[model samples]
Target: MQGTSYYIPAAAMAAALAFKVPSLVRAWRDPLLRAVCALLAMAGLVFFFAAPPTIAKVNRLTGVTNFSAPLVYALLSGFSASCLVLLVNWRGGPAERTRRISRRWIAGYGVHIVLLVVLFALGDTPVERLRDLDTYYANTPYIREMIVLYLTGVTVAGMTMNFLCWRWALQVHGWLRTGLLIIMLGYTFNTAYGAAKFAAVFARWAGKDWDALSTDLAPILASLGAQISAVGFCLPLVCQRLADTWHIWASYRQLGPLWRELDKIAPAHVRAVGNLWWSSAELSLTRRESDIHDGLLSLHPYFDHDVHARALAAAVAAGTDPEQAQAMADAAMVVSAVRARVADPEGKLLKSSDTAESATAEGTRDLVRISAVLREAPVAAAASGHAAMPESEVH
Candidate 1:
């Protein structure tokens, strides 16, 4: 159980580090990313040192019985310091203020770390007690002080994180708010873990047997808290990336009918990109929009002003607002232009001056609105029918 608990947090930290590395590589100057990465790395180290098998191996390799205790304590203190700094960096303010705040935290935690080392040195625990180190040394001289100091530091950091996360959660929205809430909940577990350890240690001092709280229960809470907090840190970034991909895919799919109709008239305008289905939706949308513009340009000669005038009258009669009616009319004109081009590919080309201003203006409007019209408007169906006709009968 101990090994499994230790490994779980170790794995969570490793995953967090993996998730942050690419961003760190791209922008090493980003202080928040650096702080987060450092926090995860230190956390992984703490769990690695705390695991029983690894602790035993360190003791054997160093030839100092129970030497891993001080090492693990130091690493835990470092992890606490890193975590506190990360929260500070996350809740950013003015540059100088953030820096000053970070420095103050570092200095304060530095004192706790120094005290941890000093108290560990003053303690005399020659027996190896890896799994039950806290309970075993609960009544020992300076070992008790070291344990209390470490727990105090951890408890303070955890409570501070909980307060910051909860306060921030209430002010934010969407995934960020949810992530902060989860982080707040994780820190609640962390504070409870600290309380459990303090209780068991105090029980020992009082000559009672509440060793299970420290030996078993606290570790479980710590492991759960670590894993949950790691996930909370990552959730917003992951959700944002997923949302962007979904938007891109939706745009690509929604723009398909218009793009396909335009492609038929001006295949030459299509970029020579391969396997468009597998290409990025953003890139495909860009290329598709470009192709539609080029297709409209090619059909400029076939742009009949009468077709646009008739479509506008039909749309207004159908009760669409003027702005939307204009879009539908423009859509109908494009359909007529496509049919004219198919019917008479080599006929006399219409002069650019003869085209309605709306036909040219359509190129500059939002493609989404145009796509919506193409997919949903009544004139769009009429346009599609004309576009689908056999080339010989298109006229």
Candidate 2:
């Protein structure tokens, strides 16, 4: 059961690392991405080797009674260093400063790892204790020092992360703030995990037995902390990508009415060929916008200024804001022009109109509003009906 708990989180971290691999390959120079990948990989390794089954397997494979002890400690130290390095890059600053700070953390943990190995080698531990190594060797010669050093390193890192994330969360908003808060919570769990382990080890030194803190309670806390921290790191990034995709697709869908109308009048050469199956939503929207502009250019000669003026006045009278009034006016003129073009199939009404050109020059939000007005505004529908009347009708 304990092995299953460790393995499950280890597998989850492996999955996350797999997802990040392609992006890291594409942007290998991205320090933040590199740090994220390293942190995830180190986290998985910590859980994998720390599992009792794996620890027993490694000890047997190496023909050493307790080799897994220093090994897991070194991995945890590396994991702690990884967390600090990731934090440095995630916060971001001047390039040189980030690199310098990251190097210092790596070097510091590198020394701790060497000391753990040296201490473990000097200590004499004939007995193998997979689940409660810290407590089992609490009073041993150099193994005791090894236990204190690794736990202290983890505790310091956890507390430092909690402080930094808490302070940063205060100044941020949206998903970023939410992610930071989650990270803080994760580190709080991690800090507590370190405290639990320390308590169990110190209890053994004081002629008491509290091995449950290390064997039973601490592992549960560490696993939960790691999994929660992984979510905290990934949530904002994944949510940001999803949010951007939603916005792009929403814009593309909103422009549909205008794009369809433009497609009807735009020449084959000017119109987008077909649905670009391979194009991204952003590119598809860009092409649709281009096609609408071309259609407006083709319809320029048939645009009626009088229709636009009357529609603008009616929209303002109806309490539409100035921006929306302009869009309504533009939509009325466009619908009127389409009707006028249909009525005069001979193309004899062709003449340049600065009014139409200016409407065509209007930006995307205006185009979106014009598209909405086409769908919902009575003024635009009325203009289309009026333009369809005979050229000699009471003029």
Best by TM-score: 2
lDDT of 1 at 318: 80
Candidate 2 residue-wise lDDT, 1-395, digit = tens: 37888888889889989999999999999999999999999999999999999999999999999999999989998998999899899989899999999999999999999999999999989999988889988999999999999999999999988988988888889998899899888988899999999999989988999999988999889888888888898899899999998998887887888777767666666554766789998898888887777778777776667777877787788898999888887887777777666666665665433354543434334778878877774655764653343464212
Using all chains and alpha carbons, the TM-scores for the candidates as numbered come to: 0.84, 0.87
Stretches of model 1 off by over 4 angstroms after superposition: 91-93, 268-275, 296-310, 343-359, 382-395
The model with the greatest lDDT is 2
Q: Write the per-residue lDDT of candidate 1 for residues 1-395, one digit (tens) a residue.
A: 56776777788779868987999999999989889898989989988888998999999998878888878877877887788788888888898888888888888878888887788778898899878888889988888898888898889889888888888888889998888888888888899999999999888889998989988898888887887887788798789889998988788777776666666566443435523677776787677667777677667666655667777787788898998877766677677677767676554444323654333444555556556778875658865443343444434
State, as a TM-score between 0 and 1, how close model 2 is to the true structure: 0.87
All models: lDDT?
A: 0.78, 0.84
Question: Can you give the lDDT of residue 77 in candidate 1?
Answer: 75
